[model samples]
Structures are given as structure tokens and as C-alpha cells.
Target: MTWLILISASLNALLGLTLLLLWRIERRHAYVRMWGWSWILLSVGLTLGVALAEPGLVGLRYDLQALVASFSLMGSLSLQVAGARDYRGLPRGRGRGLPVFIAMMVVIVALAGIDQRFAVIAGASFLVVGAWLCAWWMGRGGDGGERFVALCFVAIGLVHASGPILDPFSRSPITHTLGLYVQMVLSLGLLLLSVRRAHAEARRQAERFEQLAHVSLQGLAVIQQHKLIYANPAAMTMFGLRDEAHVGRLDLQATIPPELQEEARERHRRVLADPAARIEWEGTRLTTDQRRLYVRSLSSHLPWDDAPAELLVMIDDSSRQKAVDALRRQALHDELTDLPNRNFAVERLRELTGHGAAPFALISADLDRFQLVNETLGHEVGDALLRAIARRLCRQLPPQAMLTRLGEDQFLVLIEETRDRAGAQAVAEQMMALLETPFAVGGTELYVHLSAGIALFPQDAADGPGLLRAADSAMHRAKGRAGAAYIFFDSAMNGATRTRLEIEQALGRAIAAREFLLEYQPKFAAGSRKLVGFEALVRWERPGLGRVPPVDFIPAAERTGQIKALGELILELAARQLRGWLQRFGRLLPVAVNVSPLQFEDAGFSARLLAGLQAQGLPHEAMEIEITETAAIGHLGRVLPQLAHLKSAGVHCALDDFGTGQSSLTMLRQLPIATVKLDRSMIDPLPEAQAAAVVSATCALGRSLGLQIVAEGVETETQARAAEALGCTQLQGYLLGRPLSAEAAGELLAGALSAV
Candidate 1:
């Protein structure tokens, strides 16, 4: 047991010496070095003092070792407490009082162990003070690793206080060996924690410096009074300053040329007063011995100490200002035409309207089917057309005519001091005629029509915004009428426009009022006279309005975005009727519904339709939808995808009014449609041989493309016979069946089924 105790104590003493050497190397890290040095001394002192007390070195030398051990423990404990508390703030002074207390306690303990008379009273005093310090740390809300350190302190105090009574226990070899091991391990753990914390703090400071350097865009330099102390890499290149020694002695004023010295000083003072504000200064710099630089520097001050400050400066060469000016010009003008854009147009209008003068007329013009021109000839040609139109209009305009391009296909012309209503009307006609002239774009002759709306100054509108609005409204009215004619803004036109807007708003509310109903038109097989399918047409039976024509309300609904909700409502009604028909007829005939162009634009249209069908528990194949060629061609790319998605989901797509569309048969073939319905006009004069040949040709084309051809608008047996001769397998019109209500259509199908 004695041998084991000696071996353990000796090993601990060696470790303590190594730690003391490491502490000397890292003395600059005060918290870590202090704790580490204290641990190393404690370990060595405890090992030697405990070993010597076992009765070999019997007197003052042994007492001195015990004294050294006590002082080391006290020093190490106090440092551990301070390092833990250092999270709040670093502690000051050497902490000499703790060491003094431990030294007096150690002397008293040595005397008590030697059986001195006053030893007991002195030991009691020392023990009370040590215990008070441990309790004091505990009372200050000690927990975590810090609480463990405090507990070790309390244990150490109790051990020393019980020294006289525990003479027998202290003499035991097992107790001394175990006690020495525990003390060495505790000191090493506490010292390692302190070292970790110091390293972490060093890393945090480095990170803060890195963040500051990253965030600053301007060149930064720290100067001490008149001399530069440090310059960041940006500062070095910005001012063309040399190395650190040059920066250390360089005066900032030396960088500015003599002529600009006063301006530089004024800007510098402003920066010093407000570090956040940018201060501009122009000065010449010497690029080399012979070359001189004319530089403009935007600078700000970053003060580090009260004695001196640093300046963060951004330098731009004056020669590059041309590029900056180009960017500013591009922002205000249209890039395609290099003309003053909509932003500039609005400003020009405001400036023109500011003057109180005679009548001036504002004319707003839009190119008819301009989108079609772009689609057919390409955007390059479209731009060339616009530029040519702008040049032609410029040539025709009087000196007072202010022409501004408003949008992609719209332009605004402000003519000041127009000759009353007749003169204003004549100017608008001339402008329209000039716009209609052929534009030679990329060697292609393009004919474009212009719709112009004239709003007279001080009468039609009193202000710029109002004048623009009136012109825009009148332009719509002009386009609504036939041909290339210009219309003056009038109150009657405004009333009609307001009525359309009111109708659009009313159509939105009609869907929720149960005013919408399904009117079904039955499809016959022509040969068997059996009902094959029913076309689902929507009718709005408003409470006071009675039955509204599909033409009037449908177009209005489509234009005003009431179409999507209306389409969904119609689909739900059709699906419900189909389900009921299937329940009664014992077999389901596909229901054909119509979809508007705007409805197809929604990305979620396919998913919503499929989910609605699934919710109704009806198979998707039981429904077929008709899309107009106008709608399909309006957004070909988006519509093609939407059609493909519907086809993939087992729904049928039919192109309605096939030949009436501008899209050729080749374009139609590219679409994934299962059927094509010949327009009503084709069947109107169907008995005529020329019309029959056209129908036959269409039917042959449909057959070649594997598309089912349904001939619509068959009015008589002669028309039906002609359609049959043309190989039309399905015929639907007033001849076979008119559009019927849900119940009437159901009864018609039932009667037809009975006949079959």
C-alpha cells in the first residue's frame, strides 16, 4: 500500500511539472496560464508534502512543503472561480488575499499536527474563513462546472479543519493515495476547461475582424492623428499607397492635390461629424513620376479612438462616368426603339397639362392585331415596324405635336392648340391614315391599322390622368366600331363603357346566386338516330333579367375574368347531370362542355378539373370539352400543354369553329384534339354543291387526321343528306335537336333510346 501511494504521488508530481512549463509558454493568455500554473504547482506540492509528512524529513522543511501545498490549492481554486466568472467580465488584481489566508492556515495545521498549544484555535479561525469563501461563491448562484469547483473547495476546507481529529485516517496509506489522485485529476480538468475557453475567445475576436472586413465595400485605413497606422488591401490600392512603413508615416492630406486641398478639408470635416454620410471630394493623384490622375473620391470617416480616426473611401475615375451616364439613359428610354418610354411619357403629359392655355387634343393609338404581326413575322420585324411607324409619325407631326410611345403596341400624341372639334377630328384622321401606310420591316411589307381616341383639352378632361383615361376609353370605342375611324371622347361613349363594366361586375355575382343553369343540346348518330352525346351550354337566367343570350353575357364574362368561376360551375352542373343520366339510362354518354381562353391560362386548371370529376365519382372519359380556335391560338404554347394534360387524363378535346380560325389545317393537326366541329356557317348553305365540296374536303381532312368530324347547324333534310354525302358520321343542329334543358334533354335521350 505504501509503495502504491509513493508511485502515484511521484507520477502526479511529474505531470504537474510538465503543465508548469506549458503555462510559461502561454503566459499571455492570463486566465489559462493562471489556472494552469496554479494546477501544476498544486500537484507537485501535494505529492511532495503528503509524502514527506509520512516521517522522513521531520521538521520545518516538511512544514514548508505543507505550506506550499496549501498556498497552491488556494491559488488554483481562486483562479478557477475567476475564470468561470470571467464570462460576465474579466477580474482585476493578483488575488493575493486568498493565498495569504491559505498560508496562515497551513502554518496552523502544521503546529496542530505537531501538538502545539495555540494550534487548535488558529486552525479553527482558518477553517471558518475558508468555509465562508466557499459559501460566498455558492450564494452568488453557482451551478454547472463552477458549482463543482465550489464543492471541491468546501471538501478541501473540511479536510483541513478535521486534520487533528482525523490523524488516524490521515495516517492510512489508502486514504493518502486516493486523496492525492482525486486532487490531481480535478486540477487537470479545471485547467483544460480554462484553456478551451481562452482559445474560443481568440477565435471569436478573429471572426469579428473578418466580418467587419467583409461588410465594408469602401477602402478602410486606420490613422493615428496625421499619420496612417494601418491600411486594408482596398485602402492600399485605392490611394496608391506603398507598403506598411509608408502607410505608417503617410499623411492623408499628401494624397490630395494642392488645388483641391480646401475642398478636401471641408468634406473631411463633414465625414468626421457624420460617419454614415458620404462626402465627395475631387483631387489629382500622381499615378507615377510623369503621369497625373484626376480622381473623384466619395469618402466617409470611421473613428476608432478620440485622438485619431480612420477614413473609408470609394474612388471612381472620371473617365468611367460615361458608362454611368449610359446606364442612366437606358433606365429612362425603351431599349428596343431607343425612344422615351412610358415613365417619360407620363412625365411629359404632366408637364404639358401644367400650363393654362388654349385647347390641345390628346390622342391615344393602339395597333390592331399587333400581336399577330409579332407571331407571324417575329419580334425583330415587330420592333422595326414600330421604329418605322415612329419615324413616319414624326415626319407627319407639326412642330407642336408631342409623340410618345405608351406601351408595346400603343402610342400617345399630344397636339397643342388644335383648331376646334373639326380641326382636332381632321388631325386624328390624318394620323390614322399615316399609321395605316405600309412599313417595310426586314424586307417584309406589313400593313397595320391604328385606332385613335381624341380627348380635347379643358373639355374632355381637366387634368393629365383624366385626359389619358378619356383617350384610352375613346380608343376602345373606335376599335369596337368598323374600320379605321377615330372617335372623339364623348359622354355617351363613357355611359356605354360604364354599362359594360357594370355588366361584368354583375356576371361575377350571378354565379353564386343560382342564376346559372345548364342547357343541353343532344347529339345524334345520324344513321341510327340514337343520342350519343349532349353539349353542355351555359345560360344565365338572372332573377329580373330573364334569359340572357350566350353571346352577350359569355363574351362579357370572358373579358372581365368571371369566366373561370363560371366554367367551374358549368362543369359541376354537367357532371351532376351526366351522373343522373347514367343512373336512369343504365349507360353513360359523354357530356361536352365549353372552356374559355382565360380558363385555360390558369396553371391549376387541369388538376382542378380532374379533382372535380373524381369528387363527383365520374370517370374522366365520360366528359368532353370544346375549345375555340381563337382561344387555343391566343396562347398556343400554354393552351397546347393544357390540352395535352386533359387528353392524358382521358378527357376529349374538340376544336370548335375549325376553318374560321387564322390557324391553317397544319396548325390544327399539331394540336392534340380528338375531334373538330365544322362551324355553323359551313352547314348554313350545305345543300349547295360548292359548300358540299368544302364540307367533303373538310371531312376528308378530318378523316385523314383521324379526327371525328361533327357537322353542326343542319337545318333541313337536304342539309343532312349533303352532310351524309360528305361522310359526316355525326350531325347536330336544329334539324336533329335544338338545345334542351337538363330534364328535356334527358327525356329526348330516353325517347331516342326507346326508338332504338
Candidate 2:
């Protein structure tokens, strides 16, 4: 028994020395270091007790006995702790472990005076520590190695607990032997734990690698010696291949397109030669169904997998890149014509400017009859015409010329270099000639014409923005030409344009400030030439600006969308005048106010007109609205509904300037027209045998349509009599009475009522 005890103790001392050497090599776990010290102490104390084990021997050191007792218990406690910690990677509990162990050693030395009392104390401490270790490992349902270690700790704990009772049955040598056997068993458990721990670590690492390979967004793969050592699930999906055995063995070049194989090879070479290099490419790959896929591939150096290798990460940019390209097209091109838009034009101009391509000519063009086209036909036809014109202009333009749509009905042409003004003029002339031939648009043979203005670089102005401005100013000048013609930029045109812009600003201010007034032009019964009603013509009287004619400001107002407010002001002023005339003459003659297309299109127009009538204490019946054929034809859908609403409210509507527009009597039947005002052109060809026939025919048509006919621009009595004979009862012209101020109109109404 003594020989066995001695042999086991020596073996434990060797195991402890091996642990200490392993800890010094790699101090990964602090618990291993603590257990090593414990084993060494236990081995040394047991060795000293054996050497001094002669019973009743003289000079038997009491301190040596106490040390032996304490070291034995402490060694078992350390084994229990090491197993607990190894099961779960726990931190070193209480950083004061070393100091606390030193203090315990000092106390044990002081207790050496007691007989076996220190052994009892040491046993109790081991019981508590071993019990905790048993609980920890017993709860772990995993790891067979850990369960085996837990049972070892439990047996040692039981032995320590029963030490006091078992001591009565045995002496110190017997108990020491039992403790040696337990330590030897604990050492074997540590050996099994170490072997199992290495196996578990390898298994866990393999599982994590498999998860990464199966569930990753990027197509990850490691290539070694021109062969794929690993291919993740994403890699198979990206290459559009099934997870076949051959796929993992295929080289990178085999997966790429034949045309891109060289690129892939070069990329791999670059990554291998320079580990820091990050290479990327826009590549095409075949999908499972052989559908081509566009993607961007990236490659970088990967850690050596037994050889030089590269890591490839592929990102599919197919759908997202397509959407980005679509957005870019929408940004730089006109959606309707597919031509370059304003921004693209500006960018091209900048590019040209940067290249020192001076002495170039910029021509600005505007469609002359586009408004009439939009008004007579529809916006659909208008858009078709614009696209047709864009195509036609492109066909006639030279290769050096770049054409762009600056905005609606306006285009820009940039000529690289102009030898002289005639070179630019010749191109503009050719474009104008092409428009002379009518375009068949929407079943209508419509004539399309363009007016262009030419501005030379370094002559008209400098820079892209300045050249465009100058060209636009010249374009307006060309519009004032005899026909659709081209003109060069002149300073005077800018002045006129400036004055026009000033008038537009003034019109807006006048409407906002309520600074407009109305003049009355009376309409009479042609049969008796008696006063019937007054035409309300708007007059803008800016304080120092005097009177701005309706012809000048009305068009400006309509262009700027200030017509809605202008229409409201005219209604208000006309209502006021009508009310005053009724008070003085005791007659409520209807007042006719012209309505613009823009004003009629306003959704709030009817409500506002009715509100004005109510505020002025006037009936809707006393107000008549005169709309040009353009207004009715342009927005027929909106204008017809608005007319229906106003007619329901007892307001009168008449089609004014009828003959000037192309709308036939068929439109008159659809419209809610109380009267048809024959345009001044109708009277121009009147009072003659031929004119009388046409005039009488027009009146007959009006009568058949259930509409009253009023002849406009009647000057002579002969014309008035002819109109009356032709069945037109109402007549309006300067011959009857020129436009008069509101107060003068009141006197005129007063005299007429008195005469009646």
C-alpha cells in the first residue's frame, strides 16, 4: 500500500510539472496555472510525510504535517475548479486568487500546533469547493467528458466530508493513501477533458465555417492553385449552377464567360502578386436557365489554404444598375421625344466651352403655330407634332449640329464652329424650308413653322447661360419677322423684351392692387340701332403708366397665369359699373365680359364669378360672358362643363370672334351659346353682292342653330343695314359708340333709357 501511494504521488508530481510547463508556453487558461501549483504542493507535502513517516520518530515537524493536510485538500479543490471552468469559459473569479492563497497558507502554518485539527478544517473547505464543482458539471447536459469529471469531484467531496468520522477508524497513513488515490483519479479526468476539448473545438470551428458558407449574401469562395478549395452556396447561385460535385472542382475561368476568362485570370494574378490589391469588374454570368446576368465581381488575397489563393466576392448589380440607368436617362433626356433636354444641352455646351471651341453659333428656335396647334387640336396632337418636328429637324440637321429641346416648343442647336454668320444662317434657312412642307398630324394637314434666332460666341455674349439668353432674345425678334424667318441678335430686341417683361410685371401688380378699370362699348339692335348692352373691355391704368391697352396686357396676363386674378377684377369692376348704370337709368342692361382660355380653365372661376355677382347685389342674368372660339376649342372638356354650370346659374354665354376660329356650326350646337358674335373678318367682306350672300348664309346658319348673330366691327350704316337684312339683330362697332369711361357710359345709358 505504501509503494502504491508513493508511486501515485510521484506520477501526480510529474503531471503537475507538465501542466506548469504547458501553462508557461500558453497561459490561455488561468485555472490551469492554479491547478498546477496545487498538484505540485500536494506531491511535495506527501513526499515529505513519507520521508518522516517513522511513528514516534523524533524531530517530526508539526508544520510539515499541517502542510501535508492542507495541500492534499487544496489540490482536490483546484481540480474541481479547473473542470468547472473548462466546461464553460468563465473569467478568473476574484482577481485576488494568488494573494488569498498566500494568506490561507500562512493560516495553515499557524494551525500546525493543533493535532489533525487543521486537517479537519482543510477537509471542510474541500467539501464546499467540490460540492460546487459537482453541481456545475452535473447541470451540463452536454459533453460526456464533463459528466465523468463531475462524478470524480462528487466522490472526492464525499470523502472529504466523511473525513472526521472515518478518522476514528484509521490513522494518518491510511487517510493519506485514500487522498492519493483520489488525486490520481482526478489527474486522469483532466487528461480526458483535454482530449475531448480539442475534438470539440475542431467540431465547433467546422460548424461555424459551414454556416458562413451556406448563409452569406456575398458569393464567397477560396481558390488555391487555380482550383476552388471551397465554394459557398452563394457562389453556386451567382454562377447560376446547381450544387454539383463538378462545381467545386471547376476553375474560376470555367465559370466565367469565354470573353471574360482572361480578365478573371488577370484579376487572380493581381491579387496573388499584391496581397493588398482589391480588384473589381463588371462581369456577365450565365444563370441556371442560361439567362445572362450582369454583376460586379470583386477579388482579394485570401489566407493561404495550403497554397497561394484568392478570395472572390461577387455582388449582383443587375436590377439596381438598370434602375439607376433608367433614372439617369430620365434626368438627361426628354421623356417625350427621347432627345437631349435642357440639362443635357447645358452640359454639352459646357463641354464644348471647355474645349476652347469658340467662334461657334447657338440658334434658338420656337414653333410659331404651336399655341394654335394646342388650342385647335388637343395636347395629344400637340405632343405628336413636337415629336414629329424633333424628328424632322434631326433629319435635316448636319452631323456637327447638336439639337436639344430647351423647353416646350423651344429647341436649341449648337454648331461647333461658325466660319461666318452666313454659315449659321444657311443651316437655319434649311430648317425653315423643311417646315414649308405641311406635316400630316392626327389626320390633319397642319403646317408647322419655326422662328429661329442666331447668336455667335465671342460676339453676342460669353458663357453658356449668356449665349442662350442672347439667342432667345433674337428668337423673339425673328417672330416679329414677316413670316417664319431667322434673325441675328441685336441690342434693340433685348430692350423690347425688357419692356415686355416690365409690362408683364406691371400687369401682375395691377391685378393684385386692384388697379384695373373697364370701359363700355355699347352693342345695339341693328334693325333700329338702339342701345342693347355694353361690352366690358379691361383697361390697366398703372399710376404713372397711364392706360395699358388690353391687346398688350391681356396676352401677357394669359401667358403668365395671372389671368385668373385679372378675370376676377374685371368681373368686380363690371358689376360695379352695371349697378351704377341701373341706379341712374333704372335699367339693368347685360354687360358682356370677355373670358380667356386660362380664365375659363380655372376650377374656381365659376364660384368666384357668382360670388362677385352676389356681393354687388346683382343677378347672374344681367352678366354675359363672351369667350373666343380659342377658349372653347382649346379646353372643350373643361370649358363646356364651366359653361354648363354658369348657364344653370342663369348666366349668359356667347361665342365671340366666331368666324376667326375653325370651329363649325356643329360646335355651336354642342355649346350653350346665347349669341354668336361674327368676327370683324366677317364684316370686312360684307356690304357687297358677294359679301351679302356670305353674310346672309352665316345668319341663316345661326338662326337654324337657335343662336342670335351679332356682327362685330360695324362702321357704316350700309354695313349695319346689310347685317340687319341678313338677320343679325345685334351690332357692335365704333360707329355705334366708341369705348367710353364708366361715368360716360352711365350718361350714355341714361340718354338711351330716356329716349326709349
Candidate 3:
């Protein structure tokens, strides 16, 4: 037992010394770590007095053990005080009265040494109060280990304080020995507990280190003074490192390109000192003879250490980003010409307009008759021709210019920063010159032409799409001229296009507005000066626009897709006119109105037309539909069946503007037409070389096919004589009479018939 006493005393002294060193040398607190050490020493002093001596100093030992137990209780209180200082929620150093009580018990024990029940009673009371204070400290929830130790101390104090009071009643050495042994065990337990707590804390530190090594979106690494300490999985993969073995072999400088080393090092140094600093390593790629890595490294000094300390270097590969940029480029631009596609071009124009960068100008150009080349030669030749034209235009265009290939034959140019109209005009002239040269494909020469249009920003048009429309309108203006040419966008073009758009929109309300009116031109027989038929022509007498000629609004309606409604209205009006004429005159003379090719191609044209005629109670034979050569040739499949259905319904068909386009003697023989109207261009000259030959040939072709020929555009006597001499069966134009209003035309028709 004395040996046990010595062992306990020695261990206690060692623990106390250890705590003092950690508190003083390491500058750590004494409450949690050092306070536990104080309890170990106090427990040892109690055990030695009980276990040593011949009779084991029974009376002396009990009193001494009481004193040591009182001190041990104070250790837990000290722990609570230190914990409160650290956490701020627990009680501070406010247990001043407990120290006075400890002093009082020490004084009482000294005065009545052994065999003094009163002093023992006083010491035990002090120990109980001290233990209660320690328990209160633990109830505040300090560190887990310190709180557990405090709880054990409270229990030890309560049980052992009862021992001295009960020792006098039943003086058993074994009972006393049992109490000493319990002290021995608890001291040893606290020491073992302290060791285990230290081990656990070390393990937690390791786990945190591992977490930092792996926790980041970017690849993280630890590079000591530009040398690799560790490479995270992300960093290894980013730098193309196969494994840790690869990482162990290289440094940061070795992985980065030579040109980027100086900048990378400077950035790394800056980030290490200031945690907020972010450094971008510009070019971090490996060469053929070296390993390449793209890394944007951020370095920071850890809390525990400093020099060669640790760096949080991040590595990122930019090659995937480069590939993404390339893919984006390919998506928005044409592959062959490397020009912007329609979508990208429109988007760029919109962005420019949003910014209001400059006075932008848009030029739209379409290769005139480019489809003829594709149809006649081949698609490959056509493609070559387009590429050749594109290359030529690209070379001639200004360096700052942006060009877009809108379609097969259309090109759009955005003049972003043009100096003046002169600059735009100069660019247009350059384009024309480049395109004028003949393109040689398959060892054969082919010529190409372009009709160009210009639209200015904020003046002629407000935005990008509006500017494109303005340019398109200008191009149509150029197309109407004799030769293919370019024209600058003018306010006049805007006025005209706006007027046309208004008419097209108003066409829907024409029947409701009563603005739509029909006129008739008389058709006469060649030999007999007798009335044969009347040609009904549509004209719009708009309120403000005055008389909108059919030549102007009719073509605009067709282009704007409003002609379907317009054509239907014309037919309804003609049917109404025919009904009136037949009801009043008691004669069913046929009336012909020109139907556009687009109107004839409508699938429901027949049903709608027949329904209108039936509604007006007009005979089908008294109504005639005149179709142009272009309509008959373009949609021949849809037009022929529609014409046959009309003829089957007892209606007559006339081919208008014959011998002008693809019209010839062969097509005339196959068409369902009963009459052919010679084109104005074909009837302009006669009895004079070329004009006479054309008229004679057309007349002969018509006669051979058993079709009646109507000579059109005869304005003077000379033209009438030529048409008459050509054996034309019918003639129409100003020579006979101009197109008159419905009332006037009715009078004219009545007068002619009365004379006949």
C-alpha cells in the first residue's frame, strides 16, 4: 500500500509539472488541461496518507485526505472559470466566496489535528460546497472532456467526504483502503482520459487537413515555394498527371510553360500573403518536351505555420474553353465563305442598334437571275460561281466591313462606321466592279450581275429589320430599271413602300369600304366592227391616295400575299357587273378579267369563283378569266386543271400577254385558252423589220392553233394598221378606248351594241 502511495504521489507530481509547463511555456490555459492535472496531484496526496505508515496513520490520514479532497474540488471550479472566459456564456471568475471557505477549512483542520470531529465536520462541509460549485460549473456545458472530468470530481468529493465522518463510527482499515483505492483508480482514469483526449484532438486535426486538400471547385494543390507538395485529384487530372507518382516527380514551374513562369510566380507570391488576392496564370500549357498544365492558382498562408508553410494553388485547363469558343464560331458563320449566317448577322445588327454605335447602313444585294445558272449548268457550277463571287466581294470590301450571306442569291452588308454617303457609294462601286468580271467554271465563261439596295439607319429606317426592308425596297426599285444597278435608300422609296403597305392592309377592308371599283375595256372583232366581249379591270379609288393604278397596287398586293383576297373581290365585282348587264340588256356578252398566276394556283379558286358567279345569277359562259403566260407556265399543273374546270363549267379562258415570256406556238396548241392576247412589246412595231416579223409570227402561230389573236397596246393608227394586216381577230388598247368606270363602260358597251 505504501508502494501504491509512492506510485500515486510520483504520477501526480509528474502530471502537475506537465500541466505547469504547457500553461507557462506553451502559453495554454490551465482550466481545462491544467486543471485536470491539479486534481491528479490532490488525489495522490489523499491516497498516500491513507495507505502509508505502520497503522496507516488512520486518524491523521482521514483528516489529510479531507484536506486534499477539498483542493481537488477547487480544480473543477477553476476549469469552469477558464471555460467561461473562453466561451463568454458561462459564469466568469465570480466564485470568490468558495476560496474563503477553503481557507477556513484549512485553518480549522490545522487547529484540531487528529481525533477532532468538529474540524472533520467543518472540512467535509467545505468539500461538499466546493463539489456543488464544480457541478454548477459543468452544468454550463464546457468542453466535453472537461465537463466529464468535473462530473467525476463532484461524485468523488461527495462519496469521500462522507468517509471521514463515518470512519469514526466504524473504524475499518479495509473500508478506508477501499476509499483510497477508489481515489487511485479515478486519478489513473483522468490521466488515461487526458491522453485519449489528446489523441482524439490529433485525429480531428488530420481530418480537417484532408478536407481542405479536397474541398474546392477548382483543382487545388500544395506547392512549397513553386515546388509540388501535394496534388489533389482535380489538380492531377487538370495537369494530365496519371497518379501521385507523376505529381511526386515535378514542380509547378516544370508543369507550366516557360513564357508564363515569371507571371505565375509573382501571382503566387501575392496570393500567399493576401488571402483576398486572386491571380490568373495566363498561359499554363505544357510543350512537347514538357508537361503542360493550365492553372489559376490562389495561395494562402495557413493558421498554424508560415514559411514554405503551405499554398492553396488552383489549376484549371482552358483547352475545353477554347474548343467551346470555336464551336460557337462555327454555329453562327457559314463554313465555305466564312461569312456570318442570317441568324448571326441579324443578331449582330440588333446588338449594334441597341448600342446606337454609329450611323449604320445596310446594303442588300441579290445575284440577278442566279437561279438560271443553277438550272441550266449544274448545282456544282452554281456553288462555284457563288463562292467565286463571295471571295471577290470579300477581297474588295473594306477591312472593317461585315458581310452576311442571306440566301442562295442574296448578300447583306452592315456598314458599321461609314464616313459618309460617298464611302457607302464607293463600297457599292467596288462591289459592282468585283462582280462584273465573268466567272470561269469548268473551262467555260459565265456572267453574273447584282442588283444592290441601300438603307440608312435612323433616317430611312429605325432599326435593323426596318433597315433591311428599306434596302429590299430600294433593290426592287433598281430591278425595275433597264439594267442591273445599285440605288441608295431615299425617302421617296419609304413613302412608296409605305403607301403600298397601306393599300395591302386596306385591301382587306376594300369590300367593306366600297373603295374597290371595276372598269371595262371593249374587245372588238377584227373584220366586223361589232362588239365581241368586255374585259373587266380592277382599280382602287382610295379616299386619300386618289386613283391607285392596278399596275402599282396590284403587283404590290400579289407580292404581299393580299392578292388572294383582292382577286376574289375582283371576281365578285365582275360577277355583279355581269348580272346587271345581262338583266338590263337581255344579252349575255362575255366579260373577261385578268387573273394573276398566284390567284390561279390557289386550290380553292374554282369553288370560290363558281360560288360567287352562282350567287350573282350570272351565266358561266358570260364570264371569262384571262391568265398571263407567266401564270400558265409557272403553275401549269395547278392552272391547267383549274382552267379546264372553268371551261367545263361553260366559261371561256384567254391567255393574256402571250408570246412575251415562255409563250410560244407549241404551248398555245396545248393550253385550254380560246384566245391569245399579244404582248405590248411584241405589237409595238409592225411593217418594219423586227416588229413586223414578231407580229406576223405570233399571228401565224395563233391561227395555226385555231386560237383567236388579240393585239394589245395599239396606241396609234400605224400600230392598228399593222395589227389589222397581221390578221389579228381582236385588238385592245387606248386605240379603241381607255379603261372607263363601271357607269361609263356600261354606256360605251350599250352604245356599241346598239350601233351593231
In order of appearance, the predictions have TM-scores of 0.47, 0.53, 0.63
Best-performing candidate as measured by TM-score: 3
**Candidate 1 error regions (>4 Å):** 1-362, 367-395, 399-409, 414-422, 433-449, 455-470, 477-492, 506-515, 527-530, 542-549, 552-562, 597-611, 633-650, 666-672, 704-706
Query: Candidate order by lDDT, highest to lowest?
Result: 2, 1, 3
Clashes of each: 0, 0, 2
- lDDT comparison, 1 vs 2, better candidate: 2
Instruction: Encode model 1's per-residue lDDT on 56-153: one tens digit a residue.
Output: 34478756765665555455555445543443343533576566656776676776577543454454345445544643554356456656655655
Q: Write the per-residue lDDT of candidate 2 for residues 1-756, one digit (tens) a residue.
A: 456556656877887777677567546555556667666765665455433344333344645564665666455455546546654766545465556555666665565445445645554654556565655654478467667666666766655555455553123454556666776677667655654565566688889978877898878778775777777888787766577585665655545689888767777788888868888777687665566777877788877755568887777777887898799889989988888999998887777666456688899999987888889899999999989988998988898788899888999999887767988998899889988998888998888778899988877776788788889999988888767988899777777777789988787767788888888899998778788988998887889868777778888988899888888778888888877766666777899999887887778788888888888788898899999987798789889988988999999999999878785768888998788999888886678788788778878888988777899999888788888988997999988889998888888788888887
Clashing pairs in 1: none
Residue 507 of candidate 3: its Cα lDDT?
Answer: 72
RMSD of each: 21.7, 11.4, 9.9
lDDT of candidates 1 onward, in order: 0.71, 0.76, 0.70
Model 3: per-residue Cα lDDT over 183-232, one tens digit each: 44545545554456556767888898678666755676776666676778
Ordering by TM-score: 3, 2, 1
